[model samples]
Target: MSTSTARFTHLNPGFICENCQREVQPLKVGCRNHCPFCLHSKHVDRFPGDRDNPCQGLMEPIAYEFNGKKGLTLVFKCKECGGMGKNKAAHEDEVQADSYELILKLNKPKS
Candidate 1:
């Protein structure tokens, strides 16, 4: 990730983005910072679906990856936590599933 992206952190309990001004909530769909109307998610995770995180920070969603009949996907990474998690984007989230795919060649460490 670039220096600017390295600063990613998950959005926390805060008012909606002034840019996309709208009411926001937490976990009821994880809308703490993202503007529902704008579909802006924070970056705060390190791996897809791995949430046993120490990074208690905001996660910015870079884009969506579709799984074969599984569902829409959310790609994430946290700046503060360095934790990444991938989730099946929900129906409501699908409304904003507008995303571009990235074939990033991240260094895969020994598992």
Candidate 2:
């Protein structure tokens, strides 16, 4: 589908996470792309809100990059295709505490 059409068709639905087995709810503030519990995302969107990608891979959270303008963005690596994607962290996320802990652990400097 064209990018424009993709955006118009995009729907955020509550899903049972394939990786963590959690019943995730739709985002109250925005689109729900990732599991708020494990911070893992599916390889769905080719562009933000454009779920045109067909990889259907499990995306693992790899690292965190903080931008002054954007706050925090989580980096993800797809297990099946070895592709990477980054998504901005949400403020009203249900699993914010755990998410922050994971982000801190991943973002720590190497010794």
Candidate 3:
């Protein structure tokens, strides 16, 4: 089997934020990729919920965009590999919603 396939594991487990050291709970509806408090994520998945990425880098939230369908999406850049990815903001989640204030802070107009 390929590395990605062999390493793939569908997961939505709660974890402690590496950036802020906050205990994060799993999403009530779907996978919770980043910390709602700091909006930071680890580069651990090649595909969403598939913990197969080897980078294992700290992903920094750099920007945010709103879509009519997806609502708010946060853009991230991997600190280790310099890769980029986007994840839908969970501002409406019942359990641990993404921080709306932080999202707003990131959604500033480019100057």
Candidate 4:
């Protein structure tokens, strides 16, 4: 296999979303870092896309940040170990079942 393919093969191709229990497919644009539906991720990466962490925790989406030309990046907090991580929002996330609405609701301004 090519180096790029080899690198990608090291990452988790896809998984059943823990938060939402949905079968998530590998992202067409890049590695499947988080669930498009619930924006949750596994605590498997010590570095981005490395999948070397041993925590095996469920990462919950806590907040989001604007990434200018790249769009939004969702921040996650691992429920098991309290570690944190961030992932760029997939364009598919906006169209994933109820994800768009939930994301909007979660992003509502706080009083």
Candidate 5:
């Protein structure tokens, strides 16, 4: 689907992380896309919160980027389909924040 035509479904449901097996809570504001503890996500959406993707693969945290306006964003690669995606980090969430250490580890410069 085209970006303009793609549908966005805002569904924020708690789920267990497939990578870390951690019980994750729903986000208080935005959609809870990835696990806050492990920073891993599932390939479950064609668009944001759509939950229409059939890949159902575990997405591995590969890297991160810092934006002045958007703050920290994480990059993920699907283990099954090799598709890549990005998500905004939830480090500032009051209930369950994304791992700052893991975000730093992913953002570190390679020697």
Candidate 6:
């Protein structure tokens, strides 16, 4: 099938992340499948929900931001397609572990 002439959004979430070895989440909301700490997202959707891409690869944590009492966050940019997106961290993920590590490193009585 030729691309550029086709368009899709809904995620067919059924691929396991080769990077994290975890089941991917559906395009369905509140399904942050990526490991919160790593902030890695699968190259499933091309534009948020617009799933229309040819290069299927692992999207890595490139960057992120914080606005207010929102919450922790990170960004995932596909190295293969140059697609970028931000995702909020969720519990039962690694981000929490990272947060703890960050605090620990900060509080370490300087070796």
Candidate 4 lDDT score relative to the true structure: 0.73
Please give the distance, in angstroms, between residue 18's alpha carbon in candidate 4 and its true position after superposition. Answer: 1.7
Worst 10 residues of 2 by lDDT: 1-10
Off by over 4 Å in 4: 1-12, 93-98, 108-111
Clashing pairs in 4: none
1-111 in candidate 6: lDDT tens per residue?
Answer: 333564542333444666767555443344453553344676765455465556666777655454467565556777877877656645334323333343222222222
Residue range 4-46, candidate 4, lDDT tens digits? 7555454546678888899887765556678877778889888
lDDT of each: 0.45, 0.76, 0.85, 0.73, 0.85, 0.53
lDDT of 3: 0.85
Give the C-alpha miss distance for residue 63 in model 2, angstroms.
0.4
Give the per-residue Cα lDDT of candidate 4 at 28.
57
The residue-level lDDT of candidate 4 at 29 comes to 58
> Which residue ranges in model 2 land beyond 4 Å of their true spot?
1-10, 94-98, 108-111
lDDT by residue (27-73, candidate 3, tens digit) is 87767889999999999877776778899999999998777897778
TM-score of each: 0.40, 0.80, 0.85, 0.78, 0.86, 0.53
Off by over 4 Å in 1: 1-22, 25-54, 91-111
| Candidate 1 TM-score, C-alpha based | 0.40
Q: What is the lDDT of residue 19 in candidate 2?
A: 93
Rank candidates by lDDT, best first: 3, 5, 2, 4, 6, 1
Between candidates 2 and 6, which one is better according to TM-score?
2
Off by over 4 Å in 6: 1-15, 23-29, 50-52, 92-111
Output the lDDT of residue 10, model 4: 48
lDDT of 4 at 2: 48
Residues 1-111, candidate 2: write the lDDT tens digits: 443554445476778889999888777656767777788989988887768899989999888787889777788899999999988877447643236666776654233
* RMSD from true fold, candidate 6: 8.2
On TM-score, the leading prediction is 5
Cα lDDT, model 3, residue 106: 87
TM-score of 5: 0.86
